[model samples]
Target: MKVPFNSKDREVCIIGLGYVGLTLAVVMAEAGFKVTGVERNNHINDLVNSGKAHFLEIGLDARLEQQVKNGNLKSVISIDEVESASVYIITVGTPLVNNSKTTNLEAIKLVSEGVAKRLKADDIVILRSTVKIGVSRNVVKPLLDEAGVEYKLAFCPERTLEGKALAELVSLPQVVGGLDDASTMRASDIFGFLTPTIIRVTTLETAEIIKLINNTQRDLMFAFANEIAGYCDVVGISAREVINSANIGYPRSSLALPGPVGGPCLEKDPYILSEGIKALKGNPALALLGRTVNEELPKVTIENIQLLLDKKVTSQEKLKFTIAGLAFKGRPETSDLRGTLAIPIIDEIKRILPNVEIFGYDPACSNEEISSLGITPCGNLEDVFKDSSVLLFQNNNPAFEKLNLNSLSRLMRQNGIIYDLWSQFDGTSLELSNGVRYGGHGLMYLYNK
Candidate 1:
């Protein structure tokens, strides 16, 4: 099979049209590449053909629809499309599963096998999937070698924020690396259309390591913030206020406050890296510690509830809990809940209070999605606020911040625990409420209503 690296529109084949894949495909097409999005599932293709997007990213669906109309983007199912592209980018999922510490990179592996089988000497297979440090070099390259295909391969991990992927694709500096010098140069040239600032790494392993380190470092920072927040709760100080005030002069030290560390990348990728390393080195510091701290957030969150409920709960009253916002992050309304941070918190809530009726609410997700997790979904914002003992803010949705404190107090069951996970609440208003307990990172303020 001849590699399609000819001059005709620099044909690009992107495998997997999930959140990352679909966004990257649209970005490439808009940048004047003839893009063919290949997905194993036909559902995504149907959505694309119908001018709809499966996931929510800012202006992504409209951009994709425009590209499709302009005759620059096309969708297909067969792996035979691999033979029709100059560059094949594998943008598949790498999710962490139950009973396994490591992530399942089966999609990446399958795509690599297909690419290796169809690759020619001058072809490039760019892996845009987030994987462990040595995956590209140790796993992918070996598969290519076994298939008797000589080609350039690069590890170019996607670091685009979900809501702002299109802008970030052009602005964010991309880290790319390949097996050889020629491979690295080719990968850099191919991605030049997406972003001008490209940092080329020496080895494939180094490039892969760059992706892992980015998430692991962020995880470490968040873990530190969460740990410090607990200490702030004991000391009777407002953590968010202190951090916000101190952030004025000490710019470098200020990072995002501790919230749910779910989402796809931060929760899963670090374990893949740490688990791979632990197999060889026995113990890793930041990666393992970060995972432990992040996983423990739900339990820690539930403990905060107990602290608030101290001497308040009587035998007669039943706790009515409401969870606000279920998306992994705020903006553009995505439905991908691979490594959801809210799950642990939900699990803890269920385990501790079996009698409590937990109701979850998200603007983006449906009842079917929440029901799959064994939880009942409250239809809307008003439904969640009506007569609840506690309101847990799992995600930082901007819509939740606009809520009326007085109106919410009326909906509560007297002395309700207002668990502000992202601390998106007014301290003054919370303090004014009678029998309302408001707690967030480092500062737990109880309102005697």
Candidate 2:
């Protein structure tokens, strides 16, 4: 891919400097393009201008600071401050509506209208927000068309993970789709500065559906694993053991581990996809079912914890529960708590056992930050284990995986219960310990023993 124009001469203005937008802005600036970040929030604008990222992600702070110092990137509170740019990218959030599964596109609409007001001829406009299918053609295109501007439009959905955004932005193949050939080519040329591989699709809707399908498929696989884990619990078998044994040297099967599937993307994208399918008069039964299974996981987890507590602990009021890991996902760790299941789990625990004392510990988050979420924060692992009657491993953080269970068991109350949601530890062997009673989501043998 040859450079269509001098990269240093191209100015890229990004709308909505949230997690996705801020990271992309930093990457583009680091790639040698003069970048302008538009943010409506005064606090966020101040934070960005001061070279500090509002959220936690690996390597984002250092990179953002460097970009700000280099003068390659600057932020403004109003879109009017964006005088001119070769490319305009909309990265606004599309959150779910209140008490509904449907996507709320108010931010998208506002940003599109804001961009349209400053539209210029021959400029490239790209949307990187994850939205419902047909959003690009039906919602955004009409707004820009009404503005009477001659510009190339494209939809390039963001696929980078939360913690690994900077690395993946440069490594992963960029997916590009546009209204026409010229639009697609221009978008590809822009993204080519960051990554060598650019996947050009046929239509804008294809690019939109690709992001929806990618996330929904993963949600379905996780739902299957969770369903199997529930069945294993009923039949006195280990779902983790069955899945591992079933997949060993097997080319046909790939089963995702059963855990809480709530995240910013997985929790809402399936609903958006299902809604789009319904609008087309199609039945999205599988998508809806997957959402139900994953959404109900926190409730199911609380029910199992109640059962385990009833079997071991005699007094509910005296129970002291300590939870580990608060973030949504663990592998590519992050401090983002959007759509996290840990909060609901804590709420459910309080609803069921109001007198119980709950404390949470996550290395990714600070103690004050955790406390702000209505959770009592533990200063250290020692503080979490001491005198706690129940230990619930909620998130699958690597630090929790490396914990010495035998040594920690001595610090807890005698015959204390350890509820492992991620199957990080062998619950079967823990049941043999005299000091601790072990139980996992799929460990039915623990219930029997």
Candidate 3:
């Protein structure tokens, strides 16, 4: 029998209250279901119960507070508090293992063991974490079966963007697959409350691969853009202008902009996809190559900066390099620094110019956090611009969008170089009084001059 969509008896227990899990829990609670969030981290559990979010997400705080006030949502450190729920959704992180490309299932295994202990007949169990292919069937299902409890198991991978989770959760079509027919129906019925569209697939592996391919394809598109940008650099052409003109009035061209492509999902998903392909004794040459191209972008950026420095600067020891914006992305806006390209860029710069003074600043990140990454964090934007010979805008933060170019230009030394990686400024028209040179990715006209 299919469970009713808005049945009051169907309580939800969302495991792992991270970005994916917390957003889903809040939305589910807002949809009029009693929700319990199970988290292993004490700090996260406390933050959720106190009506605050540990990380930044657009419109998450107010909704979370409302859900807490209405008694629709509660967070706990143990899964024992989740025993009463009719549906269990696992959204734990499945990061790559240390120094290896293999998918680490330790968190999933631990959560599965906990869920298995409390397994009850007819209870719906959904895996929403991004995982390697067959993880839902091979890794998660076996744990539940060993407990000798009857439950419906399904894989419904998370596909929402980090900053737009709540909005995308309701608007985007959810892909759901299950171990059996009844399991699929139960999983679909539960997610139906969040969104009207639920795409039902035949098996668990399909759902897992669907999410993997979604991100991997995106990674490949970005890699292609970056690759083209590199080629444009060699030929003295603007990649941005070329892409924009090509995409104009064209439905076939959906090219992404070239920049540092780093985040929790894009940086790691391709590797996971390639690993899955390798496990099946198949070659994932294209996927691996795409990952290589994206990963090498930071180094390419560093090399371009070095060329500018060698031509403009008289002494390398006096050069102060300032990097602005540390977050992975800035459009939707978030404080998440996981797999941020800024770190690698900084590391590569330090390797190339060991004596150059490097400073970093970001509106979303803290001084302590930046210091933890071995970057000397600036207290203010002026401090970053002061005495800086090279300013690199790494993140696409909105704060950087409304910048007073004249005021900032006045602060920097003469002939100071500005590398706008995201094309935040007009490379063709920027005329600073202090002779500050501005160049962006694919804007070879500025570099050629």
Estimate candidate 1's alpha-carbon lDDT, on a 0 to 1 scale. Answer: 0.77
After superposition, the stretches of candidate 3 with alpha carbons farther than 4 Å from their true spots are 1-9, 316-318
Write down the TM-score of every candidate.
0.92, 0.95, 0.96
TM-score of predicted structure 1: 0.92
* Model 3 lDDT per residue over 287-342, tens place: 77778998897888888888887787667446888999988888788888898998
- In the predicted model 1, the residue pairs found to clash are 415-435, 434-448, 434-449, 435-448, 435-449
- Residue-by-residue lDDT tens digits, candidate 1, 175-252: 889889988999888788778798998988788777788888888888877877777777777778767776778857
The residue pairs that clash in candidate 2, if any, are none
Scanning candidate 3 in windows of ten residues, the lowest lDDT window is: 1-10
Question: Which 10-residue window of candidate 1 scores lowest in summed lDDT?
Answer: 1-10
How does each model score on lDDT? 0.77, 0.86, 0.86
